[model samples]
Target: MADRQLRTVLEGGGFFEGPRWHEGTWWVSDFYRHTVSRVAPDGAETVVVEVEQQPSGLGWLPDGSLVVVSMKDHRVLRHADGSVSTYADVTEHCGGHLNDLIVDAQGHVFVGDFGFDLMGGGAAATASLKRIGPDGSVSVAAEELQFPNGAVITPDGGTLVVGETLGNRYTAFDLGADGSLTNRRVWAALGPEVTGTTVDEVLGQLVVAPDGCTLDAEGRIWAADAVGGRVVRVAEGGQIVDEVAAPAGLGVYACMLGGDDGRTLLMCCAPDFYEHNRAPVREAVLVATEVDVPHAGRP
Candidate 1:
């Protein structure tokens, strides 16, 4: 495939994440701005809601209500009829702040946590992935993950693939009907298993730090290489099938396949991922490029 031309879709975000295509618009979470906004194809934008505790992942319930991850307080919030309320509180189950999430068709939300004080420069530790049922109940879906960030469910809804930023791999789980996760395995090994305890050590061993990602119709994953300045499409067994590089001096943290045709690969770009740098600035941008395959399965 030829290198796709990248174009700016939206700019001036205070560190954007969780890019999603819904109802003919692009929905994204701006970390420093403390708000979720919707962007149209023509570059117009509208703020959806403000998450005072900081918002990360986003998904919709079967009824069309929006559910977002409140990172700081470890809560999942629901937005409907212009009001936001707590949907689930998973603080007891999290070791650190929540990061990203994926909502299944049945409204079962699977969310991941930081596993350590990332911005505080703490050592790396394993964390659990929590599943929030449609009834607002929370439970542990999987455990001992190395900073699980982005996630996706298969088209049949039988499997869940999650990116482990510190582990340099994508892990898979058998998503049970009752919202249970079993049969844990490595979906893709981006690099050798990282056994480092410190953030610096882990960063040194990582070849591709997968962050927020999306699934394609061909069963491949388009994941932001958080430290690589690009988004890579990884097939099963960790082969990089394709990639889209970010502009010089910037890093791509998250991406989603969304557009009128679903082939637009929307990337969240910024100077860096540090809170001190991104939170006080608005250099983050949402850029788009065409891809061969459209999106498929749960977000």
Candidate 2:
């Protein structure tokens, strides 16, 4: 596939992640800014809420309430009618900081965690995926995951695909009728998983570190390669069919297939991401490229 041209849609962000198109608008979170915002088609940005801890993922509940992931505190905050409250707190269940999340049509929120002290330069450890039900019940959805970063649910809500950033693959699970995750398998192995490798060696050997992803109508996943500096569209069995290379000196962190027609591939780009380097200076941006397939799936 030919490399598509990426155009900056919104700029001057501390670090953007979890891009989603909902209710005819694009929603995202800036980590350092501790805010969730909505971006208009014309590139205008409106802050939906200011989170004190930090926000990563954005989703909506059944009654039109906004559900956001508070990263540092490991809480899901629900905003309804201009009011904010804790939907669920998973601090005790999560191994480290929370990363990203997706809410199903039935109001089941699947959240990921860091599993280890990433910013503190700790060793890589297995993580787990947690699910929060509508009634504020929390449980471990799946266990021993290698740094699950982003996830998406099929339109029918039958399957959940998650990007395992450290595992170098996209893992999948069958969503049962009772909200249980079973039949865990690798949906796509973008690269080999290096076991017993140091964190630096593992990072250096990754061909494509699948960070965040969105699904298209044809069942293809457009995933941002966190270390590869590109957003790749992968078909079944880890085959990369298309891609949009990031600009020089930038790393692609997250991506979503959205826009008026749903063909715009939105990518989050930053100079670098670390606890110390990323500040409120707004070096990150949301860039987009047009594709042939339209988006189809739940955030």
Candidate 3:
């Protein structure tokens, strides 16, 4: 059990989410800014594409093409050879915004949506999960999730876990060879008496709405909660053994376990999201941790 209390290593920009570590660099999205950029090891930032609609979720294809979730459009877009194109359009089905995503080792992209207006009064999480093929086709994978956010797969690629934010539950499913889910069951729930967002460092600020979750090779779930402002390490049987604080900020939107050895955690923090201006002061922040746990999954 390893833990640390860290601050934002990099800051400034729009509302940030979807932090993906690829090719020894960190890639994240500024949702409101409509841009997908890469944060280098030296802290240099470069915009890969300024996508249409707000880009929330991001992943890579087997061929190295970039796949993104277009929030406002409620569609999936793929980028290759410096060109952006639509992979799937689901505006009619979702009727809202696509929030975050994770792809499996088999190249299945799992996308989540708000199912309603989260910031402006849509209180419910209206989505099942959607699985997009490598060719950009889409289909419903599972239903009944309330604001599904971040997800991850086991290193063995046998398990799939999703964080249901407003629903206050983390669910796990079996990853089938055909990319279908089986035996969907609750993994953990946000209870009043629970402690520590991380399995280590017992900082007992717990709440409902576990926003984003990632799995370590050590088989731990690092869950980030928007309401709690803490990322918790959930062990087997729903125990929070460690915790990490989100510096001194108003809110913690999402988190990723990346970096050399996978211990470096990057967070998307914002003071507030219910703003009329929509331009965030410091949209995304990058934080590094001493623990080395590589990210496992598609995002």
Candidate 4:
């Protein structure tokens, strides 16, 4: 297949990352703004949760509850109805800020931490990947990630792929029924310079579409590249087959592969650099493009 591309479905921001499609809308997290937004099909956006602690990753539970990774605070927040509360506690164990996450069909939330203060508060290779059960129990899943960021459980829930941003590749693992990971290996590699991110932001992590990753029904895994200035698309075996350019300097963060026909590409874009002295902004764009694939995972 030819490489996929995207147009300006929308724009404007200090930075943007993490695009997830669920319940008829594209949900994204604004890092600097510390808010989670829901976007409409025509590019309109509405902020649903204004989490002050730099929200990055998002997930859902079997009962329709929402969970979010608060990067600055190192806690997970669970949203039910309209209220929020602690979903899991990891401060005493990891002692690092959480970044991105991927929830499996079994109600297990896999989360990653920075390991050290990357923005300058501290320095240590403490990066790791952890997991949280639906009942609020937290546990360690993997240790010593270079920089584990975006992640996803394959369509059949058989494998979990994590984006090691610093390494510029996707780390694949065999999934267990109990939500544990095994046989750690590199499934896809994106050389430091090769990406489709807008702006100068480095391509941190990526997501795999649900509808086709396992069967080829549109089987594809897409990464939200930061420095490459676009979203890069890959086939089943993990190859950079194509890319979609955005106006935002190629600092693409994350994306979702789903829409009405199960093929809309939703993205969070920024012009790179999170404004002189600030962190990246989670900008907006309702529908980045129409991919030839449908997203896997929850509604």
lDDT of 4: 0.66
Can you give the TM-score per candidate against the true fold?
Answer: 0.98, 0.97, 0.89, 0.82
Q: Give lDDT tens digits, candidate 4, residues 140-192.
A: 88886656777767667788877776555677899898888999987775554
Task: Give me candidate 3's TM-score against the actual structure.
Answer: 0.89
lDDT scores in order: 0.93, 0.88, 0.74, 0.66
TM-score of candidate 4 on Cα atoms, chains taken together = 0.82
Candidate 2 segments whose C-alpha is farther than 4 A from its true place: none
- Give one digit per residue, the lDDT tens place, for model 3 in 204-277: 33365677667777787877777777677887567887877776765677777887777787777777555454
The C-alpha stretches of model 4 lying farther than 4 A from their native spots are 1-5, 12-14, 93-96, 121-126, 192-218, 248-250, 273-287, 297-299
Where is model 3 more than 4 Å wrong at Cα? 1-7, 123-125, 192-206, 275-280, 292-294
Stronger candidate by lDDT (1 vs 2): 1
Q: Count clashes in each candidate, considering only residues at least 3 apart in sequence or on different chains.
A: 0, 0, 18, 34
Task: Tell me, by TM-score, which candidate is best.
Answer: 1
Winner on lDDT between 1 and 3 is: 1
What's the distance in Å from true for residue 89, model 4?
2.4
Error of 4 at 70 (Å): 1.1
Which window of ten consecutive residues has the lowest lDDT sum in model 2? 193-202
Order by lDDT, highest first: 1, 2, 3, 4
**Whole-structure CA lDDT of model 2:** 0.88
